[model samples]
Target: MVSITSTASLANALRKTIVDTQNQMSKAQVEVSTGRVADLGLALGGGTAQDVSLGVRSADLSSITNSNAVIAARLSTTDTSLETIATTAQNFLETLVGAQSGAGSDAQAIQDNAVSGLKSLIGALDTSIGGVYLFGGVSTSTSPIADYFSDPPSASKDALDQAFVSAFGVTQSDDAVGSITQSQMQSYLEGGFSDLFSASGWTTSWSSASDRATSNRISLSQIADTSVSANDSAFRGIAAAYAMVADSGVTKLGSDAYNEVLRTATTTLSSAIGDLTRLRASVGVMQTNVSNANDSLTAQQNALASQIGALENVDPYEASTRLNNLTTQLETSYTLTGKIQQLTLTKYI
Candidate 1:
């Protein structure tokens, strides 16, 4: 009876040791594998807000990337519109040079061509993407150039001029067309307006003649010319060009006046083109810079994510090794505990 009782007690001791070791092994496996020691913070204790903060920061990084993508798209579209405007300006300049092809009435044909170019320019100004006007400043929903087809030209020329002045201040319009020749218009557009209008958030307050006189002067330092001014004289150039074009007696004027008018037209168009090209180029550069910035930000986001993952992701191989070691220790502990229990004096007696 004593022997049996001693053996039973030893077996119980061994069973208890094995159970404790197995539990310890299970916990070690969970820690080594999951990285996070906690399965459910509620059962163990509680969690920190750091995890939530990390998640929020990750979301913010993603939002910034998305915003940058949108800006890049807008810059591309602006470049396209600037190109169209430049092309139209070039065509009108060509017509002016032709004067009169013997195949058609020179004056009427020139006027018609000018009108067509003017319409296209207006269209370009009013162009929109996704309900937002490209040239409408901060008021993206509004058309930059109001349509004039409903009114007769005689009745609406002044109004049209006023509308233009309202859309782009006299200062901006004049600065854009300053002193450049018509033949140079294409180059100006390619180099000037192209740079300006393509900028991601480009905007100007020159929405009226009054504003032009007061505020529409953004410096042209980015375009090669720094000597340009915003004085009343700057605007007179366009007014003069319009007068020359409207005066039906260009053929009657002495060759000198006719030549002067032609020269002035070339100059005015060239300046406008220059401003446009610069605007487009600037926007293009901005887009590239922003894209690079976004890429860097994305890389940072990835790095951060990896760091976070390191704290949470499981390592199965490490977990398995630790679990096996714990199991072996538990089995040995059980065998030792059983042999020690069997050494009771009751069994020996």
Candidate 2:
């Protein structure tokens, strides 16, 4: 039998055309709605690699900027705590000076204030945020400062007693402290006593913090220091000043010896205040650097977004126009298929 045109075959062909046109219309609708290619592989092909690279870079920058935000907040809190510690030292220094001036201020009151200041200083240095201790340098889990005033005789307090006895041949509470000259007291204050507050001594007895400070990656090419240590020189100075005045048996010493101790402690406190100010200034510098890094990251992200859009985004207006044309073609195909279905021998007759 020779091949001949049939109404059923014609209808089947029209049905296939209508289905293909409808699928195209669906893709065009998606492109218009999303302003992106419905099929990235089909649209970008070889350029897809470039789009992927840009996307990955954008994501990395986003992660860095978010981490920068957290570090910046931590540094800000550190700065506030430093301000508090500095002010506490300043107040204690003022009280010590007034007492040394013989301005009717008593030694016991000064001692009480030193005790309070030291406690406050330790508390401030141990400040924590989000369960992480701030003053422990890169070691962020444990508290940075030890309470030497607490029971069981802290290591620092024990060291102070032993050093005093070795230098003067007696404990600080001995009546022989009254016989000691100002020169002898000054020597002890500047010699073995001073070593107790030295950096190495601070780490050994007073602090568990690391000398290695914490840093954060603020940008691809830049990092910023984000933490300060309780074992820093300034903190050591503060601790020394407070310990000598608060626990060095000032009540039993002669007038000259007592004055010498006050003089040395006051000097140490003053120097610590200056150093603390500078340390806070350093954190301020880190804050500025971190802010600048975030700005740069944002700019890079914006640039990456532009490049990615060029590669992957579609023009909504063009997509809409194409979709309308496809809609008309689909309607025409449906109408032709319906007419073909109606074409039968009885209807034609």
- Top candidate on TM-score is 2
lDDT of each: 0.51, 0.87
TM-score of each: 0.53, 0.86
Model 2: how far residue 159 lies from native, Å: 2.7
Candidate 2 lDDT, 79-153, residue by residue in tens: 899989998899889888888888846777888888899999999999999988999998899988877777888
Candidate 2 achieves a global lDDT of: 0.87
Candidate 1 deviant stretches above 4 angstroms? 1-47, 100-105, 152-156, 160-261, 315-349
List pairs with backbone clashes in candidate 2.
none
RMSD after Cα superposition, model 1: 12.4
Worst 10 residues of 1 by lDDT: 213-222
Q: What are the per-model C-alpha RMSD values against the true structure?
A: 12.4, 3.1
TM-score of candidate 1 on Cα atoms, chains taken together: 0.53
Across residues 197-296, which tens digit of lDDT does each residue of candidate 1 receive? Answer: 2222112211211112111111111111111111122222222233334432334434444455455565766666666566666657666666666777
